[model samples]
Target: MKLLLTSGGITNNSIYNELVDMLDKPITDSNVLCIPTAMYGHPWVGPGVKAWKFISGKEENPMVNLGWKSVGVLELTALPTIDKDRWVPLVQEIDVLLVSGGDALYLSYWMKQSGLAELLPSLKAVYIGMSAGSMVMAPTVGEYFIGWTPPDDSDEALGLVEFSIFPHLNHESLPGNTLKAAEKWAASLKGPGYAMDDQTAIKVIDDTAEVISEGYWKLFQT
Candidate 1:
């Protein structure tokens, strides 16, 4: 599997190049399905919903700048209520799956219910994840604040990658997401993990793995 797990959306040349390399084709040639389902989980009902929806609109979409000719948003939670036969084929045809940031557990829940988790491994697309999207692809995610409280019986992710990703490390806006908090979280984790900020990404192509960053990041081990 090929995956480019990013803390932020693709915001730099290096990250864009990494994605192009992973796709083995120009992004213009790729059919990108941008999943903004995770962003749908904001706790507040009225204004919060409107806020996230506005932030996730076409004008503000990160995928738009990628130059992909065919870019569309597919909300996982909306799948079951719609025409599955139509949407599933559309999803399968994409060359890249771009997942956006929001509540990680909420995203995971919908992915599992919507059958995306089962389809992902076999797709020809590269999985591109940003923030919450990146975290849910991990075997388990060390908390970075997505506001969803899991039931006592649940908290698992897709397990697409072995270790958890703690994104937005030391980011200015997220004051509580300090390296100190990261260290404390990593200390309790069962396996290795990574703490990355916006300018960094973890690229994994089957057996090989490496950190590609334009900003600071770190590997944490138990």
Candidate 2:
């Protein structure tokens, strides 16, 4: 699995482009399994994965015509049915998983309820994650006690990686103050971690990780 972790994807297309470029073949030949409900403030209530359109340029519309097969959260969580016609094949034979940006807590919740949260980490396909999607793979998250939302005991992570991820380290590209903020957050962690800035990403295959992009890839620890 390839985890491409980014800060925030709503305003940037670098992560998406990178994943698309990394694809083994043209997108037309493959299907994409996208879960955008991870981010807080999602479209639907429970397990809000349907909110990816905001950043995908298809806001209010779940389906995007990218010339590839897609199974999105919008159609997955409907009460009546699981939408087996679209979701089953995507999950069983899709090319890759594309996780979009959102609050980490919400994302984690949906993954747990849907059961895909655990099954995804071990897949043979490409796994592309940005922001909250990547954050869940870390050892821990800034939940109830810390993070974008109030903590909840039920909110746990998939544990794909052994470290935690800190996004938007500089407070939205403000600069100068980022280091100070990162130092504070890093000090709070139990082990080594990363504070990735916007436009920057961490690409990990197997157990090796390479910092991608020119922005800061701050290493932190108390």
Candidate 3:
């Protein structure tokens, strides 16, 4: 699977272009399924209008609003009750999976529980992740980003990529998420990490990872 991980969604033209490149097709021709499970786990962003905005493309972050040929929701928490034959084929057929921003660990947990995490490696679709969605691709999100706790009481994520991410770097509203704070967070990680602002995104295809940014970002090499 290809990955386009962003702090904010496709906020700028640079990131949007990168997303198109990853798709290898026009956004208008694409079939999309958005995963809004992450929002429900977040205290401030969840189980309410915020999730609706994200699904309806009314949220500030642009994901579902990109004018795809079709858009559907894949709520991870609801997957277990249904049979795999129903949704599995749909997942494989989709061109893109738009994951929302919220609580990373909670998203990670549902991904595992819903069988999406196991199915991701075999998928041919592009995976676009915003905020917590991006963070869940890492091995661990670190304690600082931890909000909703998993049953196992671990910070472990999907580990789809080698490096971790510190998102929303230096945004005015999130005063605590400064570069210095990100640097400190990166120092505690065991592997390479990135601190990226809203306008920055990381694109990954197989083993290659590239930074596509209109804003600032720092790579902390371990």
Candidate 4:
């Protein structure tokens, strides 16, 4: 399966080339599945919902101007929370799966619960992860949360790659409170981690990730 993982979004807001290149093929007639982490507030309501409608070509969103068809929507809160009996079949048709940004620890918990921990790696389509999405893909996310939590119970990511990742390292516009939280999280780390600032992303095509663009980029190896 081909994979394209973007940290956070593209460009000043999100990087477009990386995301566009992943698709390579045209999107007009493709089957894409966008699974949001349970940490997200609403499933199919508000802004996310509105945008999804368009991506799915439902006419509810302006993005329909772009070619997209939402085939499946999965919200994984925990391992046993969904009706698995019906989902196994639906998961097969997905051509792309996108994971949004959120708490790395919490997101990892939910990915395992949703059965994706076992399924996603083998998928034949594209795997697109943003922000924390990129962080958790690494074997162990280093110095991720500068806040309170248990030991490294949730820090052992999915082991998709054997490296630690840090997101939004030096975006000056970010609120001081959020930056402080990250600083606190980084301070508590027992080992090394990679820090990525906005306008930057580290693309992991195989086991190796190629850092892209300009920003605060570093690799902390223990």
Model 3 lDDT on a 0 to 1 scale: 0.94
Q: What's each prediction's TM-score? A: 0.88, 0.72, 0.98, 0.71
Ranking by TM-score: 3, 1, 2, 4
Which candidate number would show the highest lDDT if scored against the true structure?
3
What's model 3's TM-score? 0.98
Clashes of 1: 0
Q: Write the per-residue lDDT of candidate 4 for residues 1-222, one digit (tens) a residue.
A: 455445444543234555566675666666666655622532333246544543354542112233455555666763376577777666666666666555666667667767878887677667766666676676665554422232545557777775666676655555552445555555555555566666577666656667776555665555
Candidate 1 lDDT tens digits, 1-222? 588889887867888888888886777788777787787775542235543442344434354456786777777887878877878888777888888777788889889888889988877788888888889987776544536766643567888888888888888778988889999878767888898888899998884679999998989988
Candidate 3 lDDT score at position 52: 95
Tens digits of per-residue lDDT for model 3, 128-188: 9999999999999987897888988999999999999999999988999998898888887
Residue 131 error for model 2, in Å? 1.2
Clashing pairs in 3: none
Count the clashes in each prediction: 0, 9, 0, 11
- List the candidates ranked by lDDT, beginning with the highest: 3, 1, 2, 4
Tens digits of per-residue lDDT, candidate 2, 1-222, equal 767676654234555566576677877777666765654434332233345354353643212345565544432234124644645445656676767656666666666666566567566667766667778777566432144442565434667776777776675434543766666666666666788776677778787877676567677765
Model 4 global lDDT (CA atoms, 0 to 1): 0.58
lDDT accuracy of residue 181 in candidate 1: 90
Candidate 1 or 3, higher lDDT?
3
